[model samples]
Target chain A: MFFNISRYLGRFKLVGCVVRNFLILLVGLVFSVNALANPNLGLPPLNIPADNPQTAEKIALGKRLFNDKHFSADGTISCASCHQEDKAFTDGLPVAVGINGQAGTRNTPTLINAAFFETLFLDGRASSLEAQVLGPMLNPIEHGLQDQQVIVDLIRQDRSYTEAFRKAFAIKVDEINISHVTKAIASFERTLISGDSLFDRHLFGRDHTALSSSAERGLTIFKNKGNCVTCHEISWNNALFTDNRFYNIGVGFKQLTPVLDKFIAFVRQGNNPDYFPLTAVQRSELGRFNVTKNLADIGKFKTPTLRNIALTAPYMHDGSMKTLEEVIDHYDIGGDQNRFIDSKIFPLHLTTQEKQDLVAFMQALTSSKSPNHPTGE
Target chain B: MFFNISRYLGRFKLVGCVVRNFLILLVGLVFSVNALANPNLGLPPLNIPADNPQTAEKIALGKRLFNDKHFSADGTISCASCHQEDKAFTDGLPVAVGINGQAGTRNTPTLINAAFFETLFLDGRASSLEAQVLGPMLNPIEHGLQDQQVIVDLIRQDRSYTEAFRKAFAIKVDEINISHVTKAIASFERTLISGDSLFDRHLFGRDHTALSSSAERGLTIFKNKGNCVTCHEISWNNALFTDNRFYNIGVGFKQLTPVLDKFIAFVRQGNNPDYFPLTAVQRSELGRFNVTKNLADIGKFKTPTLRNIALTAPYMHDGSMKTLEEVIDHYDIGGDQNRFIDSKIFPLHLTTQEKQDLVAFMQALTSSKSPNHPTGE
Candidate 1:
């Protein structure tokens, strides 16, 4: 009897140990999963290239260079000329007018939250913001800089610029090249992120009062019936508002003519086929195809985050849509029917009340008012 | 000698009193000016319309209605379809998609900071968010609700909804109408205002390190070289980043056709113009003109604040420009030659460095990361 009792105690002890181990393992898994989903509700930090580290001095020097309009062929346009802060870093125009009154095919994108973008440009031609920084400097339709030497010379001419370069990069004035300029600008770009939206408050902050019942319902529809989550995935915790993927919902491709296709092909190569030089038409397409050169990518564009959608209007890569209602209508129709339409395109068949609820929910995503600092020191 | 001394003391006393009063007056003036320039950034306790005081019950009911996919024609989409919480209450698309795969014309604007907007929509068509909320519901391309009664019937049929309505508004479930729906949704929307960008930190919080040197330069350029301040007026203290005015920067008017002129004329009639349905072309031309009915407002649109321009891209009223660089190029040329161009449109001669600096500065305008509190509760 004593031997049996001792055996029973030992068995009990084993079971207790097993239960404790299981609890520990479960806790570990939860933590690991949380760590994996490093959700940033707004823009993520800009990814600076390994070759270039961001320094205060370089960023300052780059900023000075950016505000100067001498970079353009006509010497009448600076990067700031269009990317105005008051206009949300955009020129507030339907289409961009380039050097010498040259009109570009697309509208300017705001630099706000640009740091988080995987590929830059409407067509995603540039893989990095640094690469994107230099595109307009040389584009004949844009700043129209004569060459990299012009930028180098301009920086060399300014003593303040030279000193700034030295302070930022520890490089001699002559060594401050286009790559460094782009790098510095890119570093600054990393700082642009807007996170504090009401939606964030509602979801992550657990502020039940932050969202109204209508908005809460709208959120449910977005996640379920609307099928918006399929493309614009709302991660486990953080909601960046974008999946950062590319899709073609058929905006510009109404009737793909052979000529248009050929032009697209030429532009898809981007500036230099050997190196990739995008033509006007190809540049017009905008998004993934410009970067990948895959036929499947035709009319495909990168999915942008919807952090401040209410402020921006005339939506789409082409800016064809006029209002949010119109945009909703287009989506209801499953996008323009084109040969290369994304498989995700399907009719939502929402009701009028449901649409209103969705709009209501969207309006609830805005940020609350807070204090503001003075603009100048 | 005693008389002389007494006289001198008397004079001194009088002078002191005069100086003290003057100083007090000056202080008062300064305080008043400061108040005018920089009012409290916090919004007044969200003005739940008198007819629809927000209640936990009403909000909950609204949430249910918003999420109900049954509101859609096909029962596949709900109010949340286009506006997802994780995506800052906007579907991460250049334009919103709606029922039956109907593509929307405008990009889904983020609800963040929406409470501050004086006007709603890209064209400023809706005067208030409440009015705007109902727009998508009736649109064929969006939810396509069969009738307003459908909403009422749904709420009436559901026991939970009926109880919720009673608890929230002290109204019978039958009383839940379109007006009540919009008011509830608008109340929720009033909560969506973000005011915590790095710029905000530097400006309001006195965190000098919040912005990089590039961003500082960009601010300077934005105020000066970029000439952005002309349209995007910076409040002396708080920076909502908008002037809330309308201007035509030569958007969407290459050469005004008769149809365009007629539309412009129609818009010039101001609010409550001859009520008539517009053709699609006329609708396209009806930007700010639709709101004000002034010829000068032709092709003009309400100025959007530059709070989160980075996140909501494919910039401008028409999402025409793709990059900030392209936008700058447009301003460099003062837009395409047009009749309605704002006097503000003038070539800005900036250098490459300046442009880069401007881009850097604009990038700084983005908000920083923070905990999202969706529920204010």
Candidate 2:
């Protein structure tokens, strides 16, 4: 009887061990599933507007609108026209030509990773991408649309669009308005995020080989000798490459004659026709002043991200400097000192080798591959 | 004697089992280390150019040059002046303003992620980024440099620059030429890559939350309803968002009168002195045809990538379209019908909901975070 009892006890111990091991394995699997399903992916979630919480249907609708070219008067250009896919969503030009072939007074900024930007436009006029979306539709130089009714008419004409609207929102087709357009476009724009640069790999993933030694050294110079970090600022998490601030780097310092003064004054009051009579030439010269009434904002422009600087050329707010060397020269001199120049403008006194090092580092910022979306079709 | 022998045998067996367990542990450690060091982590290795292999010293030198603005004629512009890091290395403007405040015809392109481009410039004039570096330096409308010797002189005058050259190239300071400048700038450009987009996570990494359902639907529309992927092919591996081709979408149709045609023909045949006489207006009208004498290539502009379309607004080659909606409207009509319009130009009868869906998809392309680079003090 004692021998039988001993055998049974041993068997019971063996079964207990097996059960514990199985339970541990199950727990591990559950934990892994939870980890895989983590929605944030270790990234900070975006602060979407209250009215436009990110939804699958809304994003889909916005994307369709983004690629559809039916919003213009002539139906010949789409959002993708100026903002193409390969050129970081920029048209790759010195200036943007609009609906009637009318040229505007600014370069197209890259939208590759623009969702992080605090303000929009070269002059920091629009506070958000959604707010800025409506500015161009109303501009005579762009799509040349007369009013909101034209967009509504175009939408009402299509059944598929009506169905898509029904699926995205409960509102009827006739109820669709400018706010809806902006919301959808904003939703789409918020999704364009670019990360995983060589620098990011080096810093975040601890991949030393991601950046060459020279590039690493250049990064040091960019932070130190080049003094680029003063304004550009590398964050611990993300690097949008802009301070989200405005400054005048002395691009508009041609002697302000009577005509120029009047133009400047008019632009300072904003682009509103009620406050000022702006000529075509004057309108072109209206930089930051057009957005803000402050004189200090004259020639002051919004800081852009440096994510894909090598591809976009004819540098500057006016697209004047052609080569990177010329651009470096301008900054080396602190932007042709003028009365309106920002106080931050000061001689960098960067050595030629240091300049080259900075350039090398910037090149390292370029990616070896482009991002492509999977086509369900 | 029998008992002693049995005890010795049992001890020997115990020692043997201990040794076996130790060996197994050692093997497991080696395997774990190897797994941790695995180089291929889902993504392919970066492609470095054979002509421009990455090196520590070279990148350092390039960074130095990138920050040095003395390379310009007036010593007022640096590569950083227009391509400020804070501004994503772009001066906020519809058109670039160059030396002596001369305004350029197009908007400044961002240098971010530019190394992947097969050809440089909006018109695809320069075949390589390296070749493009010098075009702007010598262009009368840009940096306005007299010749390459000026750059060499500027370098020779700086002691720090000379020392850096010796360390980077093992050559004398005087040996620095335009080629060296271009190479450095190009090397730096190569580093300006943008990876880690939300779409990348959604597709490649199998992160389901990377894209909203609306964005996913918009992606479908971008491929099917919008027919955008026809020209803007999204790669399987990298989503560059561009096919890198040229097309004429009727940008300067009104400007292309019979007189304009004769003048363009004169310029292309190198006989403009008698017919067009190089007037400012005539010179400005010579778009892509001036670069490639192919008549079929007239008015053809390079297709841009749409990675970050929302941030860089005032769309098109002329900065005319103020909003994405206007851009969509223009494309709905397949561009103004003209003599040299692209065959792909056709009216896309999209619904209002579809337009909104498209815009939402575009917003989804925006990055939630920005890049982090060292800022200048």
| Per-prediction share of native contacts kept | 0.00, 0.00
Cα-based TM-score, every candidate: 0.42, 0.43
- Which 10-residue window of candidate 1 chain B scores lowest in summed lDDT? B368-377
Stretches of candidate 1 exceeding 4 Å from the true structure: A1-50, A255-279, A364-377, B1-377
| Candidate 2 local lDDT, A304-340, one digit each (tens) | 7776576666677777777677877787877876656
Candidate 2 chain B weakest ten by summed lDDT? B368-377
Q: What does candidate 1's lDDT look like per residue over B243-362, in tens digits?
A: 566667766565345555565455556535446455543455556766666554567777777765665555666556666787778887778766566545666777898888877776
- Model 2 misplaced regions, further than 4 Å: A1-44, A252-278, A367-377, B1-377
lDDT of 1 by residue, A290-311 (tens): 5676555667777766655555
